[model samples]
Target: MTSSELWSRATAERYDAEESENSSAAAVEPALAFLAELAGDGRALEFAIGTGRVGVPLRARGVPVVGIELSEHMAAVLRRKADEETLPVVLGDMATTVVPGTFTLVYLVYNTIANLLTQDEQVQCFRNAARHLAPGGRFVVELGVPPLRVLPPGQVAVPFYVSDHHLGFDTFDLVEQTLVSHHFTRDGEDGRYRRGSCRQRYAWPAELDLMARIAGLELEERVADWHRSPFTGESTQHVSVWRGPSPARP
Candidate 1:
C-alpha cells in the first residue's frame, strides 16, 4: 500500500553484512542512548526497523520497542534475531499503518523517510508519527541534508564513497527534488562488481519542520548528530525531534 520501493529478499539477506558500519557498536550506542533517554519509562516505535538493527538492542537496553516495516523480506531477517514477543513488528506502510499502542518516542532513522518518494507521502509519515505518540511524546527523524552545494553549475552527480572494492555515488534531479544512490561492490574472488541503485526524495530541514508543524507538533531539538553537536550550515546531516501537543487541563 505504500508508494515506496520494496526491498527484495536478496537485498534483505545482504543488508546486515552490507551495512555493518551502521550496525557497529560505535554507531548504535550513541543513537541508542539518545533514544533511550527520550523513551524513558515509556515505549518506543521504529519506522522501517530493518533486521532489528536498532530495535533489538534498544529493547535489550530496558526499553519496550516495536516496529512497522514495509518489507516482509526485511522483517523476516529481523525475526531470526528476536522472537515476536521480544520485538513485535507489523508489516505495513509506515505512513499509514496503525500499530496498537501509543509511544513516547517514534523514530525514523538513516534517511529512511526519503524512501516515500513524494511530498504528500512524507507529510503523511509525520502525521502517522504524531498519531502514534502519547501526549507530549516526541517524534524523531534522522536525515541527510541535500548535497546540492556539492553539485557544480553543470554537474548533477556527487560521489559519496570510493574504494578499491566499493564505489558509491548519488545522481540528483533538481526539478524533482529526488536522488538515486548507486553502489558497486566487487566480489573479491570473482573480480566482478555487483551494482545496485535506490531512488529517494530529499527534503530540506525547513521543509521537514513545516511538515511537523502541519502534523500539530512543535520542533523541540535539532542537532548535527546523535552526539548532540550543534547544527550549522556546514552540517551534512541532522537529527530532529518534534514534540506533540500536551493535553489540555482545566
Candidate 2:
C-alpha cells in the first residue's frame, strides 16, 4: 500500500488510543509551553495538527489557533475533542494549503516534516508557512534526528522494550524508511494484541534550514527541547525557530 494510505489507516485505528495518555502529556506539554511563550497574545497556526493532541490544549490557553490537516479521519478526531469548535481547521495538505490570515506563530510538531517525501514538497511546505506569517513572525518545527544509518542491513527488529508479558518491536524497511510496530501482550487471552505501522521520510536539520532560507525565512533559534535548552550533539529532537524576512529587507 502507498505510504499515505498506510498512515491514514494506522492513525485511524490504534495511534490515538496508544498515544492519548502518558505519552501525550510528556510530549505535548513542553511543546505547548514553548508555543505559549512564542505566541504571547497573538494568533497561531498549526500545520498537520493531527487529532488535536497539541492544538486542543494550546487553545485552552487562549490562543486563537488555525490548523491545516490532510487526513479527514484525523481532522474529525480533533473536531470532537475541541470545545465549541475553538480551532478552525482546514482539510488540506500543509505543503500547498492556503490558510487565510497572517499569524504571529506558525508551528508543526512530531516530525510531521517527513510526511513530505520529496525535497520539492518539503520546500513547498516552508513557502506555504511563510505565506501565512506576518513579518518577523516565527515558524517552529519539532522533529527527531534520522536513525537509519545506525541500523544493520536486513535488520527488521529493533527492540524498544521487552517485559515478561509484552514485547515492543519496531520493524523498518530501510529503502522506504517505513516502520511497522507489533506489540505482543502475553498475559491476555490468545491473539489479544495490536498491530500498526507508519511510513515517513527523514530529513536532517541542516537540510530543513536550507529549505527555510529558500522560502525567505531565517533561522532564529535552535533548542534542544520545549523548555528552550541549547541544542547539542546529543539532542535527539530539534526545536528550530525561523522568522519571516522583514518587508523592507527584501
Candidate 3:
C-alpha cells in the first residue's frame, strides 16, 4: 500500500549484476523444480517478481506465470528479458494488487514478504494471495528465520556475508520486529564501497501460519528449502505451503 519502499531505478539497474550468484542455475533450479511440481498443469503467479529471475525460467519450464511488481524500475529491467506477452507483469503493490485471474499456485520467494515492513500489510498479502487462488490452490512463501539467537547479549547487528568487495549485515529492532539490511559493495578497483540499506519486518514461521489462517488457508507443508530439507531448529530459512479450501459439491 505504500510506495515508500519502492526500489529505485539505480538499484534496479544493478540488481541482476549484484545478485548474479542467486540467479545462477544451481541456486534457482531446485526452486523451479519444486514450484513446477506444485503448479501441476495450472498457472502460477509470482509476488514481487523482480527482474523475472524465477518467473522467466519457470515459464520456460512450461508453466504459465504472471507477476505483480511494485517497482516500475524493476519491471522495466524484467521487460528487457521477456516481452509482456511472454510474461505479463502488472505494476502494483503485491499486498493488494489484483491481476484479474485465478491461479493454482501463488508464490513469493526470497524473503519478499518481509519487504511489506508491517504485520498488517504482510497479512493483507496473504489475503491477496488467497483471493487469486482457485479452490484447492496453494500459496507458497520462502522466508528466512530471524537471527536473534545469534545475538548473545546487547548485540544488535548480525553479519551475513563478508568478502573483499562486499560486506552485508543486518541490524535488528526486536521490539518492532523490524530489521535493516546494510550492504556495502566495492565498485571496480576504486577501493570505495557503495552503501545501500533495505528495511524489512521479520516474522516467525508460526506467525506466518497464523496469517495464512486469517486468510482462510491451512498449512500444508513446510521445509527448510526447495530441496525438502527438514526445517530443524538450526535452519536459517524455510519454504512453506498453505492450501485454500476446496469447493463444495453440489
What does the lDDT read for residue 243 in candidate 2? 93
Candidate 2: misplaced stretches above 4 Å? 1-10, 22-26, 83-85, 152-191, 247-250
The residue-by-residue lDDT of candidate 2 on 8-39, one tens digit each, is 64455455776656346787788888898888
Tell me the tens digit of each residue's lDDT in model 1 across 41-133.
999999999899999999999999999999999999999999999999999999999999899999999999999999999999999999999
Each prediction's whole-model lDDT (CA): 0.96, 0.79, 0.95
> Count of backbone clashes for each model?
0, 0, 0
Per-residue accuracy of model 3 over 1-250 as CA lDDT, tens digit each: 5523889999999999999999999999999999999999999999999999999999999999999999999999999999999999999999899998899999999999999988999999999999999999999999999999999888999999999989999999999999999999999886999999999999999999999999999999999999999999999999999999998889
Span of 10 residues, lowest total lDDT, candidate 2:
1-10
Q: In candidate 2, which residue pairs get closer than 3 Å at backbone N, Cα or C atoms, i.e. clash?
A: none
On the 0 to 100 scale, the lDDT of residue 130 in model 1 is 98
TM-scores, in order shown?
Answer: 0.98, 0.83, 0.98
Would you list the clashing residue pairs of candidate 3? Answer: none
